[model samples]
Target: MSAHPTRTDTLVIGGGVIGTSIACHLAEAGVGTVLLERGTIGSGSSAATAGVVRTYFPGSPLTGSLAVRSLAAYHSFADRTGTPLGLERVGFLVLFTEERQVEDFRREHAAQRAARVKVELVTAAEAARLNPLLDERSVLAAAWSPEAYACDPAAIVRGYAAAAQEAGAVLLTDTPVTGIDPDGRVRTPTGDILAESVVCAAGPWSTAVAALGDVHLPVSADPIELLLTDPPDTPPATLPMTLHADSGLRIRAWRDRVLVGMGRPGPDESRQAWLGRLSRLLGTVYPALDGIRVHRGWSGALEASPDGGALIGRHPSRPFFYAAGFSGQGLCQAPAAGEIVRDLLAGKQPWTDPAGLSADRFPAVAPSLR
Candidate 1:
């Protein structure tokens, strides 16, 4: 071990969008911050994200509120960060094929309206008019949010990393954290970093990172798969990001190609089987895409919580913080998460009610490493 250890006011343990955003926020607030990443920035789950930006979570009002705030931040991301974020405000749609699903969404729509989210319940015909690529024959109703958007996840991470560096946050890539002590000493192959506070934002690997400190976070890394296909002829003027409620299929126009994402695969399912299921669902949902050639397909692990909401808050017994368990909403909720972590570290009131996102909601399943 080196005789002298590097020190910082705060140490962030991930280089994905979430960690970068937090580092940016901390540095912009004049805090001395150091961020360590196992690989290049955004190389983890953030790289493979769909980058759908919207404020339309039905069951979780906390997620909806966080997304609303995050959307505003993303709108002015480039302007504030002085880095370009390839943002496309193409709107979003949620298609429902069953009466029960419609009923649930109608309640959610009412709740969203009360929260000042600009959304409306529209018929299948109205939804089809908004997105001509969609087949309304089986879709009974839809929830439309015209203010939603899609952007480059990689760019968002890069933007935040640049802004963080500009604000004096030290970023080190290819530096994997091997172990973490309860007193904010992070062990790495290069050296040890003694920080006043530590933040574990390692996305899918967050669970293991926390375990190193004798913390048990009820977060799991689940597989999420996506496919890219050639755009159909006569694509709609505005290609809204669409989600099929019955099938859990997500589709959006990414540049000139159509990006399709499948639902979370079961534990025992194989990748090929999952892809086959997605293919069949795509054909049934959109017959026009029957012969579309798939350009590429890939899978990534998503950090998921039991309730499918984010876990953001401080540790109960230590000077540590975490922002994980975003399920698949990490990309859209990153900005707000940064602010929330910043406030928690500073002992200030967060802009949003973070009680619902506290990691303490989950009981520790293992004995402490101490």
Candidate 2:
């Protein structure tokens, strides 16, 4: 690739939410770093997200705590970063369409509570009161968590990037990174960079990046689509974000539009998935939003894992490290994941959970597949 393009103490790939956040913390820690992006920073899935920051994740105590701590970190970032992180104190609603799922929702709520997350179950009447448009007959019950939240993902990532730059970290946009070798050497479209370490925060492209080390991460490039509506935006009558209490649908009213997402989509799903389901949901859940014209439609690919967890630990085989497989939760988790990455790069003790995120927890998908 051109010998060595540039050199730094740390080389961070991708420049999206995870990368910028990691770069910020590393620079703050006095780790001379260079962040390379194939495109504009924060212009990928991070920009296309609904930005929900929830602590009600079902399992793994470390992740739950990591999310909680990340939320706290966002609060501080919003204050100084001026990104208007939109840290709405919205609670979360697990809306159920089926009777059996209500029981499951309660069980999940119980599990969440046991993990120390502030959550509970609510009846149809209570949920309807929370958002009058809800169909009491269709939605059997819900799990509510008042402390859960949302934010502006783009702003947050830009804030982290700005902070990183201010702290002496260098970021290169439109610089496609081609490969890397052990001991932190990176090859980009423009040149190569030598550093003490490489943090592969390439998001959906993580598997491709990790392959240079012969490491196979169980991450797939999955697409997500969300829609926005015209403004004169009014507060969404206290509707916390809703995950399909029954189906894969995850609905949240952000700005003036009802943002919709499905936990999983069909193999051949398209961008139309967002509009198609959202129209039906607006009619079923809240007839009031039925006629709201769609103003914008967008889609992005995320690096997802089978277990729906993140990979945030140091590499077992090389000086390469990672913060990948956020599935869809990287927005809130990035701050804490960044802090953990900084600690790992510095050879200091990790202050956050590394158990569920280590490469050891997930066997590398076969090398050929990678």
Candidate 3:
């Protein structure tokens, strides 16, 4: 670790997709940016993400707009970053099993239409044709978005890192920030950095990191669980990501294997108990996969805000900014978030209205370093 102090116009914390994306945007805009990560880039929550990119955030028009913008960026990621993202546009299908669920989706469908998103309400038979593994008989209705995609999250992070470097942004991995001053000095094991502005994009660790600067961010870490299974017999060329609205079962195909995601496990639940619950849910949702063996299962954490949306803006009384608490939507919303943060730092108006994502929207509390 060098004792020499560094200086930059903007310092970004975290190296996941969000942080990398912000760095790339800032550097591309000719800002002197430096990014520090506590671990290898994308090794945090970004690596564990399902990487499903879709513009289907029900009831949140602001999030939906961000997703729409991000989808456009992802479509051109290879051209912009000079790196392939391994993106597969297999689309997204969400299933509803009850009348109430159908009504809820109907409202969402109307909102999506108003947003000019390419989405449609489909019958069970139509959904079955889109995803053969779906048991249409059990579904009352479904929403299909043809523009959805699944990509390699790590690839996206790497691509952004490369792009940021190409544009003159310094990215340091394994450099954990130990302390932060409201006056723009950050202390790390490697050395200290003085910046005009600091951005806390440290996904699940954002709350703790902000506390280091005596700021309180209303974010909490939530658990995420996922399972990978062998491809079923007679697999389709591509499998559209499927979600069961009632049960919270999400399944998507990733290359040769299928990925299954379930709701967060209970606080007291053991790994075995959680796996058992996931198995039963899988069997009930897709009867054909009842006996399929899970190849692997893992758990991760995501920063969740009370409103289940992102917190993106500068702290009211601090000389720093934050883009966190996506509530599991960070991967898909990274591009837009990056742009928003860049615009804020530059004193320029963002393309999209960011009032809904203000960090000051939540009440301020005493910084809890604990």
**Most lDDT-accurate candidate:** 3
**Cα TM-score per model:** 0.93, 0.87, 0.93
lDDT of 3 by residue, 1-370 (tens): 1223399999999999999999999999999999999989888888878878888776676788888899889989999998887777888898888888778777777667766577778999999889888778889888888878877888899999999989989999889999998679999987899999999999999999988988778889987878888777766676899988887789988667788987677889887887788788777667777878886667789789888999898865555899999999998899999999999998889997777788656645322321
What is the alpha-carbon lDDT of model 3 when measured against the actual structure?
Answer: 0.85
Model 1 residue 175 CA deviation (Å) reads 0.7
Worst 10 residues of 1 by lDDT: 361-370
lDDT tens per residue, model 2, 1-370: 1123478988888889899999999898888888888889898778778778887764444566778888878878867565667678777777767767766656566555555677677888888876665777767777677777777777888899988888988989888777777656777767778887888898998888888756677789976666665542354655677776555566677655666666445668654784576667666776666666765567889778778888777765557788899887888688889988988887788875466677667545433322
lDDT of each: 0.84, 0.75, 0.85
In model 3, the Cα lDDT at residue 67 comes to 88
Q: In angstroms, how far off is 115's CA in candidate 1?
A: 3.1
* Stronger candidate by lDDT (2 vs 3): 3
List candidate 2 segments past 4 Å from native: 1-5, 59-62, 79-84, 98-111, 229-236, 263-265, 268-278, 289-296, 364-370
Q: Output the TM-score of candidate 1.
A: 0.93
Task: Arrange candidates, best lDDT first.
Answer: 3, 1, 2
How far off is residue 301 in model 3, in Å? 1.8
